[model samples]
Every structure is written in structure tokens, then in C-alpha cells.
Target: MERYMSLLSPGDQPPALLGHEDIQAKLRKWITRRASGSEVSNSALIISLWGTEGAGKKTQLAHLGHYFNEPMLFVDMTKVPEEEREGPDALDNVFREAAIQQALPVLCGFLLQEDSEAMRNRKRELLDRLKTMSGIVFVLSEQPCQPIDLRSRIDLELEIPPLEGEKRSDAWRTLAAAYEVDESVDWGILASRFVFSPGQMSNAMRTARTLSEWRQEEGKSGPIRWSDMVEACYKQLNHHLDAKAKRLTPKKRWEDLVLPEAQTKKLRHACNHIQYKHTVYGLWGFDKKLSYGTGVSLLFSGPPGTGKTMAAEVVAKELDMEIYKIDLSQIISKYIGETEKNLREIFDEAEKSCAILFFDEADALFGKRSEVKDSHDKNANTEVAFLLQKIEEYGEYRLWRRTICKT
Candidate 1:
């Protein structure tokens, strides 16, 4: 509870403790308790710093490591062998080592905690070794994992929350001080302009420092301009967002699309329905329940260079929504029912952003529904049915599902 100044030594750059006072306190308590050689149990403290990349996890980690006065060994789970990350084989090895060989002392106990008796014996060798090790272990993962398995052996699970309001200002002050900038600038206004992670903040400050020094060489006495800060923040946040589908705006007109008269007329009708719905559809008259399927579902049946794909892009451009082209190979998996899981990801992403779902050369998947003569046929039909159902359900809002025809 006391005001704790960081005891970080030279060469240890601790992250500026922004508005995370409560979080810092909790982490400090955990570190102190752990360092005293207390019986913390087999349960490991798993603190997950989750956010958009530029949201500052690395800087926070550095700061946290300094506060604890302990070296943080990062294990990037993403870099782990993908073959091992998937399937029963890798898990089998883990269990086997735990139950038979008494290896992987740190993770073996956690591995065998599962309820399955069959797995217990499979892992008994490894569990014996894990029962001896003490202290905390840290793993950094970009992708989500099966938490139940980890939770059984882990104790604490914390998600780093976003900074807001006063906390944002406090973060800026710390960042500015670390970078050595003129304190006269109002950072509260700047912080409100863009959201950045601690790592991003540090990088921006570092860049600003260099740029400011460069300006000083030219006899400029003022701190970094608001414009330069804006640019830095924009670059940092843009990288975090990644290369997302473009959000078409009003200014991006749809005049470039070359479609047949019927398709063009239908598209215009769909656009009108999307834009000015009440005047034409007679809002209350038509069943709103049916609106779920009201989303534009058009099959652009044509050869590759015939402008089918262009037409879909034009539609997205007109609607001011992002256009997402689903990868069919990824969608259609060889594993039974695995194809549906991939479909769920595509549909879920489209739903969240309300982006135009572009299924280029989609006849390969949505072929004429055939009788289920075999398991493959049955699975194919099921996939189609699932797709149809999802489109009918979540397509309540303005959505465009464009499928290009291949022959």
C-alpha cells in the first residue's frame, strides 16, 4: 500500500508505472511472496498480457521484471513446434514423460492433473519430476490455448486491461520523462488521440527523442511538435491493427464495376435496400424476421478475368464496409467436421466487422446439393447446410456474400 519507488538498477529499464497502481501492487505482492521461499504449491501464477500488439505488453513485462528484481525468461509458445502444439501425439509424449520417465520437471505435474485415468498412467513418469520443482514459470503465447489444462496446474490468471482517462495522462508523463522531453506540452490531449501499448509508447518516445535532438541541431528550441507525435502514434497503432480489409468509405464510389444489366440492376436494388431501407421495403410491412437472409447473396458465374471479383469489390466500396476473401483451401479441411470449424472462424470474423464475405470460385464448395450416397457426400452437404444456416442467421445486418463461378 505504501508509495513504492522502483528499485530497478542500472541497465534495467522498467516500464513507466502509468495508471496500473492496483495491478503493480498485486504483482509486487506476488513477487515478494514468491521470493521468500513460501510453499506456493504446484499451481503456477500465469499472468497473460493480452491486447492489440502495440498495446505495450513487452514494456510492461520489462517493468514488471525490474520491479520483481528477477530475470523474466520468456517462452514463446507460438514458436513451439507446431506439430507438437497440435494432436494427441505431443500430448501423449507429455503424459508419458510425466507418468513414466519423470522428465520435464516443471510441466509434468500440471500435465497429469487431468481427470482421465488413461492419461494419468501415460503421464506418471513426467509428473514425478514436476512434483519437485519450485517458483514461477512464464510462457508468452500469441494464440489462445486450452486454458482448462493450464488452469488445473496454474493459480493466477490476469488480463492486462486498457488504459483510460487520467491513467492515460499519467502514462504519457512517465513516457515523456523517460524520453526526456519538454514537460510543457499537454500530453493528456495527445493520449486521447490514439491508444498505444507500453512498448509502442517507448518506441514512439525514443523516436521523438531522436527527432527532437535532430531539430535542436537546426537551432529549434521547442519540444517535438504535436504533428510529429501524431504521426508516430499513427504509425505505431497502424502496425498493431495489421493489414485488415479496407473499410470502403462514401467517397469510394462503385462506378468501376462492369456487370450485366440484370446483375447490375439487382445490385443497385440491394444497395438501395442497404442504404435507404424504409422508403422501398416498407419497414413494418415486410417480415423483419426474413431480413436475416436479406443480405446480398450473389453468385458471380464467370471466368477469372471477366470482372466477377471486381463486381464484389465495387459492392464493398459502395457499402463502406470491409471486403474479406475467405480462403477455400483452409475452409475445406480433410478431417471429419474440421471444415466446419474453419467456416466458423470466417463467419465469426465477418460478423464482428460486418465485412463483405467474398468467396472467390465458390462453386467448388457450394456445388449443386447432391444426394448423400457416401460419407464424403454427407459431409459436403452438411457443410453447405451449415453455411446456409449461418448466412440466414447472422446476416440480419447489411452483409454481402459474393461467390465467383468457375465453369
Candidate 2:
């Protein structure tokens, strides 16, 4: 089989590739791994670069656009209207020109925007069609949407998380070099505290500089302090989560609550898990032994308003993080499986935010299974089972459930 480099233009006047070095290196490694000894087939190699919006995915791809010559069109799906992108013929229309040139298709935005049933079906069809193409296909999406049976169409896939570790630290230093940062400020601490992308970090720096000037004495700011940068980072993070779940800033603490010594001690232990997670899981190396990150979930069972909810708030206060209450009844719908889907979406977001999830009236959903009298009973039982699985799958979340009935 030819090298993965074979997919690029062979002409002397090859187009220019513009993404970052790491991404380009990752792509090269993926291609090398695939082209090592695999048999050549009519099937195309579909690579999906997935990440959240504004995480530099589309920009990186666009930069690489100059490298691909004729037949390999780098389509920016965002330019396509929401209606056109979701239509059934979206894929066929984009690929028609390439198809006529007998060139491989590089379909973008299979999951870049809000997804619908029609878009999902079209994406599924596109994956099937890629199987018969004789060249490599590159797909750019926020999240990869692979068809069940057509999963083989994907040769390699990559997901970009928030700019982390050295990359994040580098971004901070880059900002500090240009800004009036004080010697007291620690770039490493700020980088560790905020899992921000390059775009977010840039915005945060701009915000910090603006805030520094606003609070400046006689319009003259002292060297940008650590406090200013962190404050800006919090501002960026706080406003984003409100769109997903209710943002809670708890004033309550353990000292404010009157509970039994035993109960209070248990609550203290929950806070310990959240506090020591980075150290135990990351620094102490216990994270490797565990399948998932250390997540501690507690079921606050008792009467209504008997400080059950308050305990969760106290823990959130202890951790200095926010708590979000999601009513189980509100998430449960008449439609079958909708309840499970809603729960999954909530848990997924909570996993990332590291916020305390206090699901009030959980017994309504997590109650004991009943004998199957009808399909409704069976579906309810299935939902309960899925809830259990999802709880285990949420590796990096702290969950708190309250119930009226003791189970």
C-alpha cells in the first residue's frame, strides 16, 4: 500500500498546509499507523477531527486546505445554511463536484452543528458511501457521528479536549509576555485552575487587562495580579454553565447546618473526595488503578426540607464549587427513553463541570423495580437499569440524590 502521504498532492505545486505542528504530527502518525501493512481496497480512509466549537478544529482544517489540490475540496459546512446542511441531499450536493472529478470526498460538519433526525440519516448515508471511494476522506465534526454497521468506514479518529498541561501553561506564558503581569503571579497555577482553550485564554487575558485598568488607581493598574486573571477565568466559566443547568452559589456550609456527628462526618468525607481527587487520582497515581476518576456520590435520604438539600449545598460550599439541582420529574417525559436521554445529557455536562449534581426526588426515577404488568412497567425498569449504568460511567462527577421515601 502507498504511504498516507500518498493522499496529499503529488504535483510540484502542492497546496500549503496551515494547521499546528502537533495536529499535523498526529495526523501523520495516524496515517503511518494505517498505511503500515493494511491491504489496499476501494474503501476510503475517513478521519474525523472532533472537538467543541472554537477549539481551533475548523481553523486548523482550513489552514490545511491549501495543501489539497483539485478533487479534494475542503468544504466549510458552517457556510451552508442550517436548512441545507440538515437536508437529505446535503452530502450528495457537496460531493457531486468531487464525484465528477473522480476524486475522494472530504465531508466536513457531519456533527459540527445542532443535529436533527434528517442530518443524522444523511450522515449515516455519507459514511456508507465513503466505504467504496478509493482515496482518503477527512471529516471535521464537533463530535463524530458514526453509523452502527458502517463504523468500519472510519480509519482513525481524534477528540480535542480543552487546552491542557504544557499547552495551557504555554498559552498563559504567551499572554504574560505581552501583558503587564507581576512577578508574584504564577502562570502554572492559573493554567492548572482553568482548563481553557486558546480562544478562551485569549478572551480571559483581554478581560483581565480590561478589569485591571477599570480597578486601576487613577487609571494606572499595577502589574496584572494572579487574582485578576483567575477572576476573569471564573467569569468566563460561570456564564457558560447557566445555559445548561441552574448555576448555584451556596452560602451554606457545614458550620451552618445542625446535623448528627455521624451524618456531618460522612458529609465531610464527601468533600474530602472532591478536594483530594486531583492529588490522589493525578499526583498519587491511584487514578491508574481505578477504571474511572474518583467520584463520590451520596444519597441524602430523609424527610422533606430536613437539611437533606442543605447538606449538598454545604459540600458545594466546602469545595468552593457550584451545585445544580435538577428535578427528576422535570427530566422524565411521557415518551419512552426520553427520561434516560435527559438524564444522560445532564450527567454528561455535570461530569465536565465538576459541579455537585443534587437531583431532588430521585426515588421517583431510582425507585425499587416493580413486577412487569405491562410495557410501561418494562420500560420504566429499563430506564432504571440505564440510570445505574450511567452513574458508573460518570467517572469524574460528584452526585447527590435526595428522596422522600427511604429505599
Candidate 3:
């Protein structure tokens, strides 16, 4: 059995849930209504909590049990014994067990997998069991449940959004207090530098404490310094974009880029946009007026080897951010929607890393939309449109470098 899957009684302490007050309030309301039997129409209430990994979906489920004040059974579907999962009465048995204990059944791993006959049968079994079972069933997923049959059965679909801005800073403060981190540490700086989820924040603090202990053993005395916490934060990030993009360490600074005075000024202006974005958006009230297109998007068009790439590096170095050169061959897929999916992953990872994205030879992907004569043409245009949308939605720096050939 997976260690994550287990039965917990009401006496177990609920995990500390941070930075999701809206979700907590919704869960509380739902549980209260169900408990009073006033809104009790369905035999079973299926609630799906979906978000990126480490966004505290499981923590929210634990919170639900605390609110419901009942026993809770947590099951990781991927870890269930094959014999039991394949068996016809397996789900029936599990639900029966939950019923016997009067526990809320919380199921994890509802991601879309291959639609095989066995998978279809499993979905059918789960649906039937859900229709017959009573009380609340919580489904945890990395993404929203996409299967129609299973999706329709979900009563409430709540997204545990990533902690951002002040909420993220607040989470850092809360975790720092719990871990007894140095009160003098600038949590706002840490929060600004790292776009970490609450779970990631906790893990970073744990790692920071471990580092501090090692320092004590080595006779190097000090509290958990800001540097230790920063290193820990970097260690917690799993870079999923390596497969799709190449990370470029920025070494070139402004002096290294030999450009015309006008071009150099333009580059400096772009860097300024990124540097003072928070001030301009938050303090200047631009964020309230503008809902999108807040990110800095710059186009570097010059002859090949005229320092287009170097200019990008200089910008990244100026902003003190990591730079990634997106691999067009790896990102543009022949299959419809695959390109968009790949872009989404790249954008998501870039956001977490707070890195500047550099798209070299951008004409191929961002060129004028081809006239639609067939489905392929239409799909290509759609892919470009989707890329543009993601670029606008991305709240960071995106630099596109295009070669301008002399005619």
C-alpha cells in the first residue's frame, strides 16, 4: 500500500492549510449544508479539487475531514493493488468499507489516462459506486477531470490556485514562524524571488533548517541566513522545461552588447519594464485598469550574429533572472493541440522559475497566419493564436529574436 493512502480518524490533527481562504470557505459551506441534511438530494456528493502539484489539494481534503468531523479514508488510485483495482467488486468493497466506518472517501489521481476497455470499466465501476454511496467523496487531481462520464458525476469542482503576490509572502511568513526561521529574514524578498506554492515553501523551510543544523555541526555559527533559504528554494524546484527548452546562463551584461545607441536604449527600456513592473502595475493602479498584456514582450530583429541572442542575455542579466531559449523543433508538434500543451508546460515552468523566455528564429512560429485553405492551415493559425494568448497571459519577460537578412 502507498504510504499516502490511509484511514485517519477524527482525532488526527488536520494539516495547516494556508493561502486558500476562499476554497476553505466553500468547503465549509458545502460540508455544513450536507451535514444539516437540508440540501441533501444526491446519494453521494463528489467534489473534485484540482491544481498544480504541491498546491495543497491533499491538505484541503484533510481540512474537509476536520470540518466534517468524521473519519476520512484517503486512497491513491494509482497505488491500489492491481488485483483489487481490476477486480469487479473492488470499488464496491472500498466504498462499503468507507460506509462501514462512516468515513469520507477521498480519492487521488483522477488524471486522464489511456481510454482502454479496462479503464472504461473502471470508470463505470466508480460511477456506479458513487451513485449508491452516501456522504462526501473528494477527488484530487493535478488537472480538472476531463473524462465526461466522470466529470458529470462531480458535484463541486474547486481549483486550488497557486499562491501569488502578498498571499505568497504571507505563506512564507507563516511557515517561517512555524519553522522558527530567523525573524530578521526579508520574507518579502524571498516571496518575490521565488514563485513557490505553499507546499514548496514548507519544504524549502525544512531544507533551510537542515542546512542551519549542518552549519552548527561544522562550527560555522549563524541562524538560517537568507542565502540558505534561497538555496533551499532553488533545490525544491523540479525543472520540467529542460526537455522542451535549453537553459542559457546569462553571462553578458550591458557593456558586452555592442549595439547602436538607439537599440541599446530600447533594450534598457525593456529591462526597466520588468524591473519596475510591480511598482507600475500595483502602485500606479495600472493593474486595475488593464486585465492583460502586462508582461514585457520585445522583438529583437537584426542580422544574424549581430548580437540578438547577446542582447537577450544582457536583458536577463540586467533583471537578475534566468533565461531559457525555447526549442522550436521540440515545441511545435504535428498533432493538433500538442503544440499548445507543450507551450502550456513551458510557460508554467517558466513562471515557477521566474525566468525570461527567449524564442530565437521566431518567424517560423509567429509569422503571419497562413490563409486557411484546409484543416492544416486552420490548425496552424490556431496554434499561433494560442501561443500569442499565452505570451500575453504570461506575467514575465518574453524576448523574440528574429534574423533580418540583407536583400
What local distance difference test score does each model get? 0.53, 0.65, 0.78
lDDT of 3 at 276: 66
Scored by Cα lDDT, where does model 3 land? 0.78
lDDT of 1 by residue, 1-407 (tens): 00211222324776555666677678667766765656555643444444444554555556666665554433333343446434434434333332343221122112322446655543343223323334454333332224345344434445566675456657877777655565445575455334455556767777776777787888986777654565465445332111323333323345776667888898777665655433233324343344545455666665557766666666666554455665455468778888787777666655544346666546657777899899988988998898778777654233333445456
On a 0 to 100 scale, what is the lDDT of residue 146 in model 1? 40
Candidate 3 lDDT over residue span 1-407, tens digit each: 43546898777787677788788888897778776866787588888888888899988877767766878888888777666665456665567677777888888886443367777677767655666667778778887755566667777888899886667777887787766566657776567567787888889999999998898899987789865786688788777767778889889988888888998988888877766665666446576788878788998887889898999899887766778898665678899899889888888888767778998778768778979999999999998999889999987889998888999
Model 1 alpha-carbon miss at residue 239, Å:
6.2
Off by over 4 Å in 2: 1-51, 54-195, 208-245, 286-293, 348-354, 370-376, 395-407
Please identify which of the two predictions, 1 or 2, would achieve the higher lDDT against the true structure.
2
Q: After superposing candidate 1, which stretches have Cα over 4 Å from the reference?
A: 1-13, 31-39, 42-49, 52-69, 78-133, 142-150, 179-184, 214-221, 239-407
Show the lowest summed lDDT stretch of 10 residues, model 1.
1-10
Q: Could you give the C-alpha RMSD of every candidate to the true structure, in order shown?
A: 12.7, 8.8, 5.3
State, as a TM-score between 0 and 1, how close model 2 is to the true structure.
0.57
Candidate 3 error regions (>4 Å)? 1-4, 39-42, 86-88, 92-102, 111-121, 148-152, 179-195, 208-231, 243-245, 252-269, 282-291, 299-311, 326-353, 359-394, 400-407
With candidate 1 superimposed using the best TM-score fit, by how many Å does residue 81's alpha carbon deviate from the native?
5.9
